[model samples]
Target: MKKNYYYIAILAFVFVFSSCKKMLEEEAENFVSPSQFYKNEAQCVAALNGCHNPLTSIFNQGLILANEGVTDLAFLNNQNNETRFELSPANPGMGKGLWTSAYQGIMYCNAAIQGIKGAPIAENRKPALIAEAVVLRALYYYVLTSTFGDVPFYTDDVANLATLEKVNALGRMSASDTRKFLIAELKAYVDALPKLRTSEVPNNRISSSMANVLIAKLAMWEKDYGTALAALNEVKTIYGALAQYPLEDTYFRNKNKPESIFEVQYTWSVSGLKKTTQVACYFTPPRTANTSTYNGINIPELGDKANPFTSVSPSAYFMSLYHVWDPRRNIILAYTYNGQNFTRPQSGNGTGKPWMGAKFWCPGMDNLADGNNQKVFRYADVLLLMAECANELDDVALAMSSINEVKRRASQASSASINLELTSYPGKVEFFREVREERARELMGEYGRKWDLVRWGIWYESIMNTVANEFVDIKQNVRPYHEYYPIPDNEILRSDGKLHNNAYK
Candidate 1:
């Protein structure tokens, strides 16, 4: 089997950094010894850049499929077995890719942290760099724990090939322990990071606001509403006057707009060192050659050619939840086919149905790569999260204000009846339900659906009612174990029995 490109690059760096002087001197090949490499700031910065490369593949594919494909909002359309909740310990696509990418990213971060500490950089510059690496490591751990439950957690870099095998022997950390570690680590970094996005390190780099957002997400996952609210309030204070970060309708364009709090940066220009996103190819509709059409519709050409893989389709239940005039409906549901506005097919199997969410579509892009930055956190997401925290705290007034901010933005784009009034939802339960629905409407296909459902304690029941109904096979095939994906069989084998699958699985 061929080695993953990311693994090859990161492993090569590890050998360079940790290899002994005798090995470097005896070897006739090119190798930059750690002592020589850490003598300058440029090398340290280059090492930091390597840490971010794995995230490009994570956001472009693995994270999106794992989070969205199993949810009611969408399912993988490329005959991905994981979409049907048929994931197994040996499922390479769903389990192996994510596990490997996240851990490899963590290794790069650890190497960066160690290298930067010894580098002869400015005294004041060290804290921010170290903090950024720490926060990034926290993010990788958070993703791993969320998806696979318990995973082997480590902070030190694997010093040699032998050390790599020893590191694999470590046992998995408990989920609660992983969450506590992430929260504590994030809190420690918040003070060291820049309070706001700056010209030097914009939204793409980890800032205090981004750190707080991660804190809020972790807190919310644990249902610790008070902690989540505090972190969100800190984010609000940093951004200043929620009005400063109003929702932008064209937020999806790759301009790095003000609405973004944290986004993974990608570039169109290819280089040996640079990384790009593949969303435009995976999410955009295929076009035919004879006519500028898609699925028999004369739509304007978006991608260069019609590929075997197409956009992930929205579920019928998800499409039905929106009102006809809702502005988001137009943004998310409408797709042009044969010169007609087609949102849902008139007749067909519900699972295979096609619809477009314009947020991820990018016109005029090379094959499988686009410059559009993948949004990890946005101002709208923060507000909706605030609403959820406030609702849990029984602060109905705050909750209403928080959620209405998002609705207010949606109402402006189109005359869609998407407005929500305080009077319409009299009770807290009713209001919270609408808040959930609002999040689904605003964040569909953006990779928040499964986590939202899981946190709401409605993942199983919601699926049993919605998508499972249309595809009866789903209900029969799914089990409680399906909630979290199983650890890949290869990971288990590599661990030498030190790690085990989630107990529920």
Candidate 2:
């Protein structure tokens, strides 16, 4: 695999889209000051692209060995199992790398929001631009707080040595307060912002509806079911129909289907660096990583030859949660070749046979520039959010219908979904639990699991149980302090512990 030296051009905001690599691999000499760029409209918007770029990184390919799609190590690996990463804080394993990488993205979003707001863009363009910056920043904070407990929050720029002190004074903010602030901030802009972004939209950028779906998502994750329902209802009113084509045809195995509320756009090629979505390059099969021979099987440039990418396989315990007869069961996972035989192992580890949880499909024969948009928040999630909200109010019928709707579409059925019901014992709490577990299975491998657990209040318990056997592994050890990430060491040392006032500390 190649190193990420080329990222110096995007070091500030691109933290969210690409994977983690050593600073040694990046040329320190190439670092550019913000003052040198982000001077005007075009430059500011370019800066926004850098902010959104990291979305792809954190979701699919940032920390290679620690697949974000495969485990919520922050909770699952460290909370329930006898995992070492949870026991050892300084362990050079994947969990710490993921922890560090996610925070780096938060830092990038913070910098972009601050830089764009302070830039000299015209007043006429400033509100929308500021809105975009805030939306992205809120997104960064959302992902950060969801993964690590008390991530230091920043709404300003901290560029120089003396300025970095502000960060040290902060500790973890209450997750509840953090969620409320972010959700409100995003809701305020979704309908008011422009439908289409002036810069990039179909390729590595976000739009108003994208913000809408995300707000809905943020609401759902925060367990504000009523608010989440209201938010997604707004989205459905504006952009929910899939009449142009069957929802399933556009969704399921095909990437960038019309129902996509928001996505990470990619234009990859085997040649010199392009504004390609690095995600596909990082997760496709090893055979597709360097070749251009297989586009016919998947959706984008279906038969084009392509290179293969490596990834951690899905957990065996989770895999058993599926219903064998479901069509999407096969479509969502590649346990057997051609949907029947066991997948051959890409690595020989006991559970390490190659198994792809189908979400993104790279065209085999096409170059990296196949233009496949990675759907970030699709209608399906909105539907689920709505259903969850319905369940919260004991509207079992609506909840069942909503889940069934998503399932039916995944199964390519034209009529509403069938066999929907929550058979759990009594109360809404039990039903809510069932809804969440179902989502875990239905929405696996999409970087939403950890947040789901946290929002449901099982994050602490899960991590504690997971790391019970790893008493020596500091990384696996779940400290009450860990509910919020530690303030970055640099920021703490600089702040003299005064500015933000140690949140988790």
Candidate 3:
């Protein structure tokens, strides 16, 4: 298998698209024009790779911090100034990187789809390649609309100056329209993608199974449980019979594990800033020696001797949810420094938060570029979503069985004390509550909590309660407008008033 070094050039292409107005409009003197570039299969693949580049940026520390920080699981370091509910359109931490990077990636997908159609590639190969680009475009738009509510949505590539002007003058689409378009596109293109990656780099590319998982996710967002269930059942039909796809504890650090349906690939050797993800730098605690003792107990050496900025920490509320025997607590919270474990201090280091877990810590890398592949969709998520869908569909037996699958894995990894049974819960509501809490425990720091809360329509209510009790300083800022992030001020300006802010405020 070849290492994914091809993404290095893709990173450069992302920068080019980020700086230029229309990808086709500004041709560098040394670079071939878009019309002349996609002459063969290799060239078309490169173009598609460029579309995948922005995902690295979208999942990086900046966006993860914003997403997780706003949820109950974690909080940004105090110096960042943007609290859970205190964000604004002009706030520096209000996810501009996510907004811009997602759109840039979408534009690349649009261009790649257009370019591939004109390429001289084999007829058998064109549909798969084009399907790959289309699924990715839907993924990017999913992130955008979920975060900002209504956004400027388009599918056409800006092939010339006039088309670029026309696109720039377009207004934001209704959220309903955006969701409908994405559902239609995914349904259309999913069949063309391969069932699994056949390249030397196995999980680096999209597949039909991954697309189905994404479709399930989008359907769940729209509260369309029937569609979501059908999509997930399709995934089950393909992967459920395979013994390799069972739930496991080691999927976090292990790349392309059977549980992973789709992941953003990252490699240290990819040679550019986008080559690696910065999750370790933001989540790992400072690498101080074990000299300091808390309550006369020695605090173990915290992180590796790397520049882990330690700018994000798990909330006390989040830590309190886990029982001592829960396997995920140790994986999600860094109470132990080095090898020696210690209790969290009551209050000291900038609001006195507990450190993030070893799941994101990279032992050998001591710099910003830690090569951790971010999991976008995984099998455990599919199980959990199935549980939720089954519960909503009034199938208590299926819901309990699905939720127990995840719990069974957790219990095997830890102790029997953490094990759950269908009899443990009193009723359906309690079972559903456990399911939600289980998601928090299992998927913390993976950037799913805020969206989960938002889709449940409890984001504002839950954050308001958390702020009023644990963080009174930010309590007053909690409002309905905080549900969806404000559209970036720059995007609004670029649209020349065609784009408007989210309507909550």
Candidate 4:
């Protein structure tokens, strides 16, 4: 797989400090200190690549369990505590991996930003390079606060053991305040960042488009609709005419296309360097019962004989959201693929079977190693968010246009409608409900379903009302505090009581 060459730069970090703890344990005599390393532009860029490494670690099944598997869009059939709402500070399940990766990413970003600031590079050149690290730090915080809520916040680099100890002893900050700080920080550097599409950038590097989308995302979390809409509008203006970036590019046939705003890049090779994702195994259905040769459901490119692990399945309610006229139905969910039937036993709201469709399926899968980029932000998501903001701001016409554009794209022609107009609904509340459903149709399995529910003040209610059989335990075990996961017990122990767990009642 041909990947952006910057990924290769991450190899350079092997001689540098990998983490704060590693610094404390290992001597700097044999390693390249930050002061010795960040003197040149190439080293600064390499530090940015180091910041990107943790993304792969962060987007695994653990992230899915916390973000999507427990939500209305998908389910984990296993007895994982995250799905069953049985999580504790000690057994945070997937939350442990998420917290670890996010902080790891944050640490790398802080180190890069600190290094770049003192790098003797040209004054004009610093902003763009530093901008990448800044946005990346904000992205990590977005994940941290979105999942854990009110986490220990820091932007300082750990220069030595003392600084590391101070960071370790820091207390939690309010999620809202953290988000506010992130928004302001991102806005400060967004313009300094390059204005390029994912295709134009290497390895889906953070661009101005991604910053704007994230700004909108953070603003929405704060219920600051005006700010969110403004940021999204900036993206629409920059990207221009969404048709140029087709939805088909969203498929893994080729990644980092123009439509992609940001993604976690992956590459797999049997004879060479390989960094892969397990997303395919997480979504693909198991072999059909009473059949041999994997039931002919194999994707030809990936040695069709490989069977999927079926670790996660789409909820019946999520599958049922598709309209008969909706062209996205086939793209997002599958009853059949490549002339082979997809079948599963009765489960999850008793709707039987519908596998996670083409958008996520990996063709060249080996074992659980699939080389597909996990999408973080895309153009369609921006449009849907715009529609949501318009509804909240009472600009019904804008709301209709924003959502209708998404429908038109899905239908592949103009004049397609799904009752998104003001007159089509009784009032703004009904219109807002339609917007929620539209967002689900566009971004169900990608991310942010649980965050959407929580920000809209409906996570607990939505899960309890969902009729999926898989959600039975969740409904019985869920509480209001389940909206945010508990802090990992090890983190609390490490913090010496400065950090605390959620009040999980």
Candidate 5:
């Protein structure tokens, strides 16, 4: 079996950093090599598409996600099992995968910046492309700081293996400092990004509105309530309310919509030299959704026998996140081979099982079918963030309204419709908890939850309580440094024993 490339991406980090300067410099000097790319506009777009390529394949899409999911909240939500990060705390491929993927995202962004910078695009188009690159680079930096407090910063975007290695060698930047840099980059560049996008490119790049969303996010992280609210209001004013889509209509309703600020795209194709959308299909039940070898699932060949470890089954705790009456509960967690709650396109009649994590919306396809996009950021997020920001600012009316907008959409057809539009919000601490619950309910299974808790400075505490109070996992991993993941051991070794242990350790 092959190793997890997500881990390889991080393990390679120290080596990449050490050798990056010489690596890129020593290579051929043309923008992108004639051997591979750099032909024209389409190629440039394709290369940008390539920048988002990593999120599709890492750990075979076994991404339970980070911040709150693996730490304590939902996603895989296991404790005491051998593979459980919540129990074991660290070092496994699972926990490390989160750390690695974000770094790889940064690496990809770096390459795109370098490639586009040297591309021979017209001057007017250049700013738009550059804005995409800047926003992407900043997003990665934001991840770097969020996941591991002090991380190496690389404004010198270059594609050379050596250039990458050199940046990797530099190690980390202060989290507080990096957040400020991310703030400035988005402010300076996000507005120029193209607003028009299709599924193919929509989730693959950032937008002006996405920049505003990012600003709101960073401001919240910085505890700059004033700035955060201001930024969020801008998103509200510019984007208008999230165009209403009944939350229960279909899994794909609001997704891939224009309301999407940013998302990750996946494609399943055979000759995937540029990108591979294999994982989601690999995990899809063979009998249904044209995933079977016999069905000619529109994919490249899987590894003869499939990689089945990637199949998802929710944690018991995850199932408990929703009330028994909550409509989304069954759609998300509990499953049946053939039932209303279970996923569809199940082959082999109703007998074919529908496991958890049908959220990606990329079921059976050929080995290389591009899975539907994953919305990393959206207008709905703005509403939720604004609610939190309003709560922080003590504007109960606005806070409730912000939360209600998301709730109204989420509960459009349900027995409950969260109507905060007219009601007052609870106190700061109370609204804070409500916001967390709303995020968990609305954004469940997405990558945002765990980190949202972390940013609130309540991750470790909440996880500790949730485990002890809810799941009975008295041994849930809780440590100060849990707020910031450890700098991978290999990278720290480069400090020549001078590296201090993370607060958690």
Candidate 6:
């Protein structure tokens, strides 16, 4: 994987992207100031690519922790403060890293959008490039608002130190207003974006499909089902039938496949440029630190030698949701590796737990430089979201049809699985409950579980329903305010008394 790095000279937005290909590789090529850059199409493209850097930075751990680590579907075995519900406004744990990373990406997007608009590029090329930056900006905001209830919001690039300080000192915006603003912002550029999948794009970059996915997601937060369904319809048209793309091919086994709407690109290399992630380390089975052996037994499925973080793994409650005949049962959970049985935690403790299935396994991923591209948005998630919207809008038939597509694929038509027939649950409330559980069974270990429950106004109560003894601390310490992590305390200090911390129990 050969990569070239171009240097863009914005003080706040100094990151590297490939000069030849689509990968966001970081290196120094030339040091051109903001005033002299974005003079051509290539320069404009480089600016847009830089916006992707912050997303890669956060993907390693911040994203996994904030989105999945604390949710009921996954468990962080190391007693992480966030996963244990022990974090606070002062000691925010993963929230601090997420806050810094998301804001940095937003700054890059803000600068790139302003730069691309003024660049002397071809007129026809400007919209797509600017739209990429626009969507990227919205994505960063989405991360911030979803994680923390409210945050300081800005779309324009900072001019100087004085302007930067002013922006930093701004107060928080309401999450509702912020999401509404981002939804309208995306609509302005959705048509300008090409209606294609990320795999069809050169670097698996943002497409019109991705923009619509984000719009639908933000709209779901607002409880606007009509807007969400309309956006998802556009995605359905672009991605085509869901049956053609299988779960095995679309996830960890490959990168940038047909169903990939957006993936954080990663590469592992002993020499040259290496962009990789630690995401796989979390979900992999618990092992001795820096070794693949557990209890002095080597698991070949976890690679010959690797560094496993012993972090997140499937919860007992989550594993209980899958039917025995479901093909996805094995794909999503690893019961045995290489003919050896995995064990549950002895009694109540969470040790010797099973790995998070083949989808997250990275063989020989020593030192946590796993080359697997993290799936951010995919076709399966879009289908489930469509079903949720349809059910909410009183179109039970459309809802059933949409969800059944994913269920049919998981079931593999192996038997007359009663659970596979989502249409059987004709009542709206009953059907919606099925949709929620189906989301857990299908999208588990992926992002947005806590958000899914929160948007439905059930985050606090849902986690409370867990009977798993390993998560006793989570149920004991969780509160209504825990639905949204508090804004990192340092951010409040940086805001010059303008930003306030979220309330605690």
Among these predictions, the greatest lDDT belongs to: 6
The order of the candidates by TM-score, greatest first, is 6, 4, 1, 3, 5, 2
Residue 469 CA displacement from its true place in model 1, Å:
1.5
Residue-level lDDT of model 3, residues 100-158, one tens digit each, is 78877887898889989989989889988999898999889888877887788888776
lDDT of 4 at 278: 71
Q: What is the C-alpha RMSD of each candidate to the true structure, in Å?
A: 5.6, 8.1, 6.6, 6.4, 8.0, 4.9
Using Cα atoms with residue i matched to residue i, what is each candidate's TM-score against the true structure? 0.86, 0.68, 0.85, 0.88, 0.72, 0.90
User: What's the lDDT for residue 452 in model 2?
Assistant: 63
Model 2, 3: alpha-carbon shift in Å? 30
Candidate 1: segments with Cα more than 4 A from true spot: 1-10, 14-31, 160-166, 198-203, 240-251, 269-278, 296-310, 335-340, 343-354, 416-418, 502-505
Error of 3 at 118 (Å): 2.1
Candidate 3 wrongly placed segments (more than 4 Å): 1-31, 92-94, 197-203, 241-252, 269-274, 289-304, 337-339, 343-354, 416-418, 424-426, 502-505
Over 4 Å off, model 5: 1-47, 57-72, 75-83, 86-108, 111-121, 158-171, 195-204, 248-255, 269-326, 335-362, 365-372, 415-422, 468-480, 495-500
**Candidate 3 Cα deviation (angstroms), residue 255:** 2.1
187-290: candidate 2 lDDT, tens digit per residue = 77665466742223434245676676666667766666777777666766665443333534333236455566555544445674344444454444444333
The candidate 5 region of ten consecutive residues with least summed lDDT is: 20-29
**Across residues 1-505, which tens digit of lDDT does each residue of candidate 1 receive?**
1234335645566564443222101222233554456556656655665566667667766667667755777655455576666667876455677788898788878878887898888978888888888888887887787777778888876655555655766888877677777888888778899877522253346678788888888878888889889989887776544445434433345455666677776655434323456665556555665444555555454544434255666777787777666666756665443336443454354333556655666554545656676777777788889988888888888898888877766665555445543454457788788888888888775666777787777888888877777665677777766767788887787667787775535
Query: Per-residue lDDT for 216-297 in model 6, tens only?
Result: 9999999999999999999999887788887777556488899988887787766755777787777676676555675344
Q: How many clashing pairs does model 3 include?
A: 0
Question: Which candidate achieves the best TM-score against the true structure?
Answer: 6
- Listed per model in order, the count of residue pairs whose N, CA or C atoms clash below 3 Å is 4, 82, 0, 1, 40, 0
Q: For residues 1-505, could you state the per-residue lDDT of candidate 5 as single tens digits?
A: 0124334543543333322221211221223242244445554555555444445544234443444335454333244342243322335334356556666667656655666667777767766776766676676666656666676676764444565456545745677777777887787776676544322343335666767777777777788878778766766666676535445433431346556666554333445422333434423434333243322332233333333333443344555556544555545543532233333425567434335434433533434443444456766677888887777777888888778877665455455543323255457887777777767666765556666777877776765655434344434544555555565554456545444344645
* lDDT measured at residue 383 in model 2 versus the true structure, 0 to 100: 72
Model 1 clashing-pair count:
4
Model 1 steric clash pairs: 297-337, 297-338, 298-338, 325-416
